[model samples]
Target: MREETFKKRKPKIVVIGGGTGLPVILKSLKEKDADITAIVTVADDGGSSGVLRRSFNAVPPGDLRNVLTALSEIPELQREIFQYRFKSDDRNLDGHTIGNLIISAMTDMHGNIYEAIQLLTKLMRVRGHVFPAAEEPLNLHAQYVDGSTQTGESKIPKKGKKIDKVSVTCVEKERPVKASRKVISAIMNADLVVLGPGSLFTSILPNIMIPDIGDALIETEAKVVYISNIMTQLGETEELNDADHVRVLHKHVGGKFVDIALTNIGIVPEDYIEQEINEEYLLQVEHDFKGLKAEVPMVISDDFLLLTEKSVYHNGEKVAEEIFKTAFNSQRKIKKYL
Candidate 1:
């Protein structure tokens, strides 16, 4: 009976980030015995999301749309339909995805992105909570090593300069950027807070740059784990290693907040990545065990690579297993202390 009860216990996890990587992790976590809350970045100002952000002054929907689909219990066909993008000569609708448009319309109806996401989470039967990091769209600013700064998520990396640091400012309003109403509470309540398998400067840092969300992460009793990216990114993390990733995050948060670091030791075939895949991926991230040890208390290094379609990604199932185990172990230790 004790074993059965242990198996049935659910760990509350809050995943924070945006971009292509966020949804991939969310999809895998949905299959686990974990209650999940996704705190997504709204600092996107590129692609279809950017166009909508400019047109409707709504929170960029692309990341939120992907997150919604990843956690939704809806049928596969419906999910495909929601994600479907139109290709046409018509300039107005050609680049916009069905999900983004729907989210834009919903934001208009609800008068805010937070409420829009909440209602859609139910309508689509999303298994967990999804909240925007900020209520309004935000602009990302990156300071380069040369003392130059660039703004806009899509525009930052395009400058091809090494970034020193990044920050976020309110886009639609001049007021200080704020996390969505539920974001702080969710982080404080989580059993584990997962940072990223996403872009370091653009996707992950933008969420943490928000004052309240960063504070919540620091104050939360939950263990913080970073799913270090497997490959280095061009114009972003060009030559960064696993430890550099942790160090940068630590600096942004003002202290060593991360308890664990998940490092990928899997090998990627040198010639396997196709041209499209190489666009962002410069090389495999070099390992820096000594540096990682200096930042985090624990490091779990393993073959977390998933290669397919001429690209590299984290093995989501493997990652979810480790995450659940960590959360469960921490809970057991806490209970013993109590």
Candidate 2:
């Protein structure tokens, strides 16, 4: 391709997270010309993914599946095929998402999860890339409020105990599959690196837990921005406000991992609040990012969340839009080679 063609391309953006939050960001960012690489955490151990991981000795595929669907250009048919879940009744297909089974099978065929994801990305014609944080099947270990340890990522929240801290454990030598050279290069060369609106412990932090990945993020010259969660997670971040979130993140990856923090300042409508109370089990609180005294400046906006009928999350487009605005503003003032 010509240099002009490439230069006309949007800035490269690497978003790190897993599960629903990642896709929401991806979906919004894809609208822009930016190149997106979603580096997903693979420590999930629940649902159809849990069954496959235990049976086949594979990295949990639920998060990967969600990311794939989010980036995929295909219509409802392909997405439905990928997201199809079997019933819990007696059958060989029970409790498994079609995407998980397909990914597991691809991993078996290619003998690696990385290769399988690459293949699927090509098949789906994703706008950007999606890679697992590590090649090995990993487990998340958490120390609870009572000082008890929980082993699985899925089980940690359900335990109903406050999480004291969290860490990732690999089945093999702790060398984190060395984040794809392309990913590291992207981070090193990126104009902006976005963390997440995902789960603090399970989704977002897992990426930083990888030593090499964390090192790359820390060493990268790009401006780093973290999008804080809007509501408190039941078990993981029970009473955590914006400042508490940053403190926990600092404790894990040290204070230098972030450059800026973007948080929602909007209020949920009263009807929306009632719906959240009855269905989603979430309560909105004022995020205290001001108290963090972070090195990077913090930006707050009235980016209201979109609530779904499923009683879970709505789209994160408003937050993503604010993030892009902040990034663009930052880049305009700071020269690329500076």
Candidate 3:
């Protein structure tokens, strides 16, 4: 009986990605009580993070700040304080977020990115593990189909070129960075691994581009599930269908090995989508379910769609609930009665 109970343990889920999309799912997964290990990308090179990186040579903290806030158990007031961005025009403080600065300070104190996260986890009362994909800041390099190459995550999309592949290197250096052993161990031990609803190229790929983490994805016993973005991203994934997303991921990873693609299929009220003026989120993601299933091992669809006041998003709690059930089912052994 003890053995059976042990076998039915809570699912260990490692979620990979960064940007606004990551926090949405994480907050949901935390409520569902899954063991979550968020492996965030360090390839950020724009805005407040970029300015700080240049000024202090620190790892980009914007993504980490958001993830920490998402999983933080602190009261809403405190969490909000951390997430507050200054709107001042002062050269010293304009566009800087309090959370980013805190992370920067933490990084400086510990002299280690990993250690800083641990300290913040305790302070923020975080529910589960949060890890930086690499200790050092990373630069994203994209090789476009036209045989052209560009470096920096912020600049890649602006070129308006079709991406062939992408890789991560040490920021301002040429060497490849490897994820810490803990990040790899989390993936190896997880019952299920989830990729993003973020920018596939910039947010998700950078984490997997690390040599060891990439290899772990190919080798880990864990089931891999990808959360498809609800809407098309203009530069990164414009005019692409669901199948195209899967194809891009597999091509970069060197195989069609992703076990499942959890896609959002529910129709958005056309007027609801139109109310927002941003052109990027206007179109719902196109579907090619047959193609996704053909390349990825399995494809699952649902009404994971969510709408905030001004935008559409994946309902994180819904995703977490479904993902937990799927992982639990995949990992548990069901016994038949005679």
Candidate 4:
């Protein structure tokens, strides 16, 4: 390769997950100028996305919408238009978000959700590439604490029972959507890979459930890092501490536990804790890092919490800064060995 070509090559980063968490991380990583690839889970079956999936046989568009918004550099007006939802007395428009409908329409025209997203990405001039874990709309099935099973991703958390395990089902067994050949090439050449800060079962684990996808992660030579969530989700991860989160993830991904586990150690103010309690939510239990698998080192940061009037959550910029700091430190150590 020529020297000019080497200078133009951006670091390749593969981020795995869905829901709100992955987008936040993506937003921050985009600033660092990495060649970003997001592998999003497509099993969502709720609200507008669920309606489109059931009615049109399209891949769930909710996560894809979030990824688009995160990567968007357009004006706020365009972004809000993409996120607008329809509300009406008419049953047809009752609960659909405009973005879901737009994506569904594009899928119909383009003949595939992936292609629809590519068109949108080009229009938005997003900073990176996005891919779904599977091409078909998938159902998330789970065994619950009450000994019954739930069949949809949206319904699973509402069951108010402990989740034993989660798996995907289609009318037939679906192969892992082969990531763009470029995505696999990125993984092979990457310096690091990141997972989580998202819903454990719903967001992160679903990606690995895809057979070839799981193999890709395990086979990649990159160092894998997991960013832990700041709070437990109401129904699905009700009482899961950080270590429990890691263990559940290990159970799903087999033996591929992360090389390093990054967790937020900041204490939420008492008022914020009370606010969450008032809303019927609980703070995540402090992680027992010592009890987790001995091989992974736990890195903690006090700057994790972002306390706002409406919500208390992780600050993506702060989290990403910590991740990059840790990753580079690891790289330096590896270079010494080489």
Question: Can you write out model 1's per-residue Cα lDDT over 93-190, one digit (the tens) per residue?
Answer: 99889999999999999899999999999999999899999899899999999999999999999999999999999975569988889788778877
Highest lDDT scorer: 1
Candidate maximizing TM-score:
1
Clashing pairs in 3: none
Please list the C-alpha lDDT of all candidates, in the order they appear.
Answer: 0.89, 0.76, 0.86, 0.74
Off by more than 4 A, model 3: 172-174, 332-338
lDDT comparing candidate 4 with the true structure? 0.74
**Best to worst by TM-score, what's the order?**
1, 3, 2, 4
**lDDT of predicted model 1:** 0.89
Per-model TM-score versus the true fold: 0.95, 0.88, 0.94, 0.88
Write the residue-wise lDDT of candidate 2 on 181-213 in tens digits. Answer: 356665676768888878899888877887777
Superposed by TM-score, candidate 1 places the C-alpha of residue 282 at a distance from the truth, in angstroms, of 0.7
CA displacement after TM-score superposition, residue 332 of candidate 2 (Å): 9.6
Candidate 4: regions farther than 4 A off:
1-9, 145-147, 173-186, 277-280, 293-295, 298-300, 326-338
Which structure is stronger by lDDT: 2 or 3?
3
* lDDT, candidate 4, 1-338, per-residue tens: 56555545455567888887788788887787566777788888888888888898889899998898888899999889888887899888988888888889999999887788889889888888877777677777888767899887888888788998887766354653444334455555556778877888888877777666667677776777788888778777877877788778777768754777778777877767777733535675577767555636554546577777766667888877766665444431112111
Error of 1 at 198 (Å): 0.4
What local lDDT does model 3 show for residue 175? Answer: 65
lDDT over C-alpha atoms for residue 335 of model 3: 33
